[model samples]
Each structure stands twice: as C-alpha cells, then as structure tokens.
Target: MDIATIDRRRLIGWGALLPLAALAGCAAGPGGYSLDEGVRRLLTLSTQRAFGRLLQPGGFYEDQLARISPPDAIGAGGPGRLNAIFGAFLRSEAVRRRVSLALNDVAGRAAQRAAPYVLESIRGMFTADAVRTLRGGPQAATDLLHQRIGGHVVEVMVPELAGLLRSDLLSALSAAAAEQTGIDYLELGRTVAEQAADGIFRVIGREEAAIRADPAATRDPVLIALLRR
Candidate 1:
C-alpha cells in the first residue's frame, strides 16, 4: 500500500485488544489450567497486546515512553557541526512529519507480524526454562525472551524497514534529505529500522517483566493446578 494509505489506517487490523489485564485477573480467580497451556496462552496474548498498544494510532510517537527519533548524524562533519547544517536543509515540516509517520507505520507493521513469530519463539524457549524463569529475578523471563527472540527480531524487522523505505514517499524524502543534508540517507533508513526493532524488543521486555511481577500470574488457577500446590 501507498504511504498515505498506510498512514491513514495507522493501527491496521489490530487495535482495541481485549482488556487482557482484567481478563488475566478474572481467569486467575478460578479455573483448571496447565502451566504449559497457561504459558503459551499468556505468551501469545501478552505479545499481541504489546504489539497492539505499539501499533495503535499515535501509539509510538504520541507517547513519550515509546517515541523514537531519527538517529543523530555521525562521521566526519558529524554532530559536532554538521548536525545543525543538516537540520537546516532538511527543514520541510511536511516532509519531516511524513517521514516520522511513515517510520512509525513501518515499525508498527513489523510488530504486527512479530507477535506470532514471538509466540512461537516463546513456546520453544520458555518450555525449557519455565521453572527457573518463574523462580528467578523479576526480569528473568524477559531476559530469557530477549535472548531467544533478539536475533530473529532483527532478522524479521530490518529487511521490512528497508523494504518500506522503497515506497515513494519515504524514498523521495530520503533522497531529498540526503541531497540537502549531505548525509547518507540509505544508512539513515537502516538506522530507523534498527531503532524500530529495538523499540519493539524494549516494549516486549517490559511486558515480560509485568507478567513476572503480577501476583495473579503466580496465583493463576490453571498454573497453580499444573504445579500441584
């Protein structure tokens, strides 16, 4: 789809996710459930929820917590001096807004795809480490998740970022910004992608931490039954 089209439908197919926090608490009160089933469902639901928040309209850019900006210029004539010069030439407000929107859109799209892939990764990784991770530090599950999915995230996201850069609006902006600012626009595209991937990982890590901390998760009826007291 064209940049304009994608920008308009910013959240795409996934938005307004079920209030999972409330649901988890409710389900934890009474139910028979297995740890394996609980883990898989929790992993899938939590990841989808994370991505849903991330991809929502103004989700990334609107929130100070998730906002991302273009990487600072680096190299000869780098941030020391060239930064201001580059900024001056690439100063079209419209183009700037469009670029920001487009980058977020690409990131959101990649995140949508990532939700399922991450669930699969979690199933494989969490199964082996479930016991230790549950008893370990608050961030243990998150850390384990990062280790399992870090490489795959970059693999899945960067190329999509590059691919999105080929769109007309982004390509035009990149060329214009490059010519006007004398910065390597291509590298900037990759930087945006890398940052996007980083943002996705960062938020998912937070989700893992939240799940780890939730008392209800520990008290989850299904999970408790699986552990047999």
Candidate 2:
C-alpha cells in the first residue's frame, strides 16, 4: 500500500526478524571490510559464550540471546519457520538501562581489549550476508561471510551487534520484568522498543508475517505514526 503502512511494520520487523535473519545468513559474505583478526576473536568470543551456557542452567538469562536460546531461524532447526517479515520499533533506543550495563560483563570479566574490533569484523561479515540474502542483490547469497563483512561494515555490524550487545547486557530482562511488572502493554512496549523496538523483537517479527498474509488485517495505527516520523 502506502509508504507509511510499509514503515510501521518495518519498524517491528526491524526489531525482530532482522536480528535473527541477519544471524542466519550472517557468515555468508560477498563484500565489506576485512578484519581477519576480528573474525578470529569473535570465534573465540562465540565459543566462550557457548561454554558459559554449558556451565550455567539459566544460560545468561532469557532464551533469545543465550546459547540456549533457539538456533538462528535460518538453520535447519530454529524457533519458528521463516515466514512473512514484519517489524516494529518504538522511536526510542534507550528503553533498557540494565541490559546496557551487562554488555561489559558478557564474559564474566572486563571485555577484552581486542574484542570490540573482533566483534566489529564479525558484524561486517553478517551485514554483507544480510544484503545478499534479503536484498537479492548482485552479490549472490553464497559468498564468503568475511568478504561481505568487509563490504558492509557500518550498516550491518553497527546495528546488528547493538542488539546482540543489548541482549547480553539485559541478561535479566525477561526475569526482571516478570519479577517487577506483570507484563503490560506499557512494559512490553518498552521491552520491544528497547530490545529492537520490535517487542523484544519477537512480536514485531510475527506482525511482519501477518502483514504479508493480509495487509488490511495489519491494523495498528502505530504503524502509521511510525511512518510519518
């Protein structure tokens, strides 16, 4: 339909599916900067985080970002099947403070000095893959993730890891919310907006699929509001 209609849903889809979608096609890169060092470090970080999950029961809080969290939606086994895409994100990015604090503690110690660059490199890889997978561009979907990372550094890595880091920081997000508030629209709004403005990025994903099924059925006025801004 109109641009606004598309945007409202995109905001939510932006929140939810984008993160997981990015992850699924993440390593497949076709363009972007090169940080061989960063990729190596990320592999280390990823493995370390996976190890943490093995040692802990809760697995770093909620099941989304934790190692125990569901597999990337793209892989053979994941949360829900990849369906239609939708996204919702409140305008605010700073909805959660506690989660931000936890980023430093992701490894149970000071973040390694080399980790940021390493993570950045990994992010670049993911972004390139996203462009190929989602955009269906000249870059085929089956390229080196590193090449893509080198190609689309800022667009992919910045936003992608921002969410991942937020997830890491908010190790207690779901738990804390359940404990303090009884889960209301207001809280959930904050949760969704904060995480990705996508309702913890999950509902936004669901909405995207809905819109594709029946755009007329996508009846949230907020979508309109999101578009105008």
Candidate 3:
C-alpha cells in the first residue's frame, strides 16, 4: 500500500503508544510525543507526499514550478560568430520543449530511485534544535532538512539521471539537438538532477507550510500535539 494512503487513525494510535523511553535522547513535548519525534514525523510525511506526487506521470512535465527548462546558456551566446549561430538553433522553442520533456522524464525516474536515499537521510536527521525548528517559519523544518542532506540527495540522483539520459530512448531524442548544437548530455544530466532535487524539496516545503497553517486538517495527533506546544 502507498504510504500516503495509510490511515491517519492508525498513525495517531501508533504514535500515542510509543514509549517515552524509546525516545530517551529527545526532549518530550505535549502528550508524551517528543518535539524531535514530531518534527521527524512531519518531515517524513511531507517527503512521502512529495514523492507520491512526483512519481506520477507528468508530475514534473506538467508542473510549472517543477518543469525543467533548457539551460540559459543555450540562448545566451558568446562574442564569437560561430557561437551565435549555434545559440540561435538551440534557442528554438521546439528544441527547448523536446529537451525539457526528456529531462522531465529522466527526473521522474531518478526521483523514484533517489526516494530511498532521501528517506534514509530524513530518518538519520539530527533534531537537536527541534523546538526552534517547530517554532520557526512554515518551511523551517524543510530548510533544516535541505541544509543537512540536500547535496547528498542530489549526488545520489546524478548518476541515476545521467544513466537514464544516456539510455536508447533519450539518446534518440537527443540526437538532433546534439548534431545541431553539440549539447553536452552529461552536463545536462547533472543540471536536471539538481533541478529535480530542488523541485522535490520545494514540494516538501510547501507541504510543511500547509500542515503548519492547519495541523488539525491533517488529523494526525502527533502533528496536532506538536503544533499545540
């Protein structure tokens, strides 16, 4: 079953049942749930929800905020005449759309593979400042998560995205662009991977903000309890 589909009541009951001793190192907040655990749980839920949306077809392609565009350098040529000629071809809307679609496809798959790494990072996250994180802005937890592991997650995704970009399917799509502009597929892969990682965090941050604004709407007792404090 999808983690996003898990019943809220079950999660609430489970959280309520957790022994305080199990969370010994962390400081407890209201209703026996540690602020650290609360922050962790919130980040976990946000990450899961972000991945759930991103794993879908057209997740990146259709999302205006998440969609990958052709590199700006493609349209910005240097002083050389030869560079100007190549830049014009690379700037074509058709070329940009084709490149973006390929990048989005690769980003979706790379994200699928990177999900485990992201979750592992979240699980190992240090919540030494949980109270400050919880009390800060809506995206405070997400900002902290990114500061801690964003680069690592992007690194984990790079090779996977690069591999996909080199696959037969993408290679076929890239052939025309390559012949016309000598586009560097490897660098493109890295750019898309980084952008994809950013998009994932952006979605997670949005979820964090929404949840904070109305924790009761989530119906998760742990979140509600944490917010109350």
Per-model CA lDDT versus the true structure: 0.55, 0.29, 0.71
Give per-residue CA lDDT, model 3, range 26-92, as digits (tens): 7877777678777877887777767767777768888765777656552212436425545565577
Model 2 collision count: 33
Arranged by TM-score, best first: 3, 1, 2
**RMSD to native for every prediction?**
7.5, 19.6, 4.9
Q: Which 10 consecutive positions of candidate 2 have the poorest summed lDDT?
A: 82-91
Model with the higher TM-score, candidate 1 or 2 = 1
lDDT of 1 by residue, 1-229 (tens): 6543453343322322312232322223225333344455445445655666776666667655456574546223566555665555347677667666766766666565565566557554334645555556655555666676776776666666666655733364556544445544356556765676667666766665576556466554543443333
* Stretches of model 2 off by over 4 angstroms after superposition: 1-34, 37-40, 43-56, 61-123, 126-186, 189-229
Q: Any runs in candidate 1 off by more than 4 Å, and if so which?
A: 1-39, 74-85, 89-99, 126-128, 166-175, 181-186, 215-220, 223-229
Supply candidate 2's per-residue lDDT for 10.
Answer: 38
Between candidates 1 and 3, which one is better according to lDDT?
3
Tens digits of per-residue lDDT for model 2, 158-225: 34443443355335445443323222323222232233211111222232333333433434232222
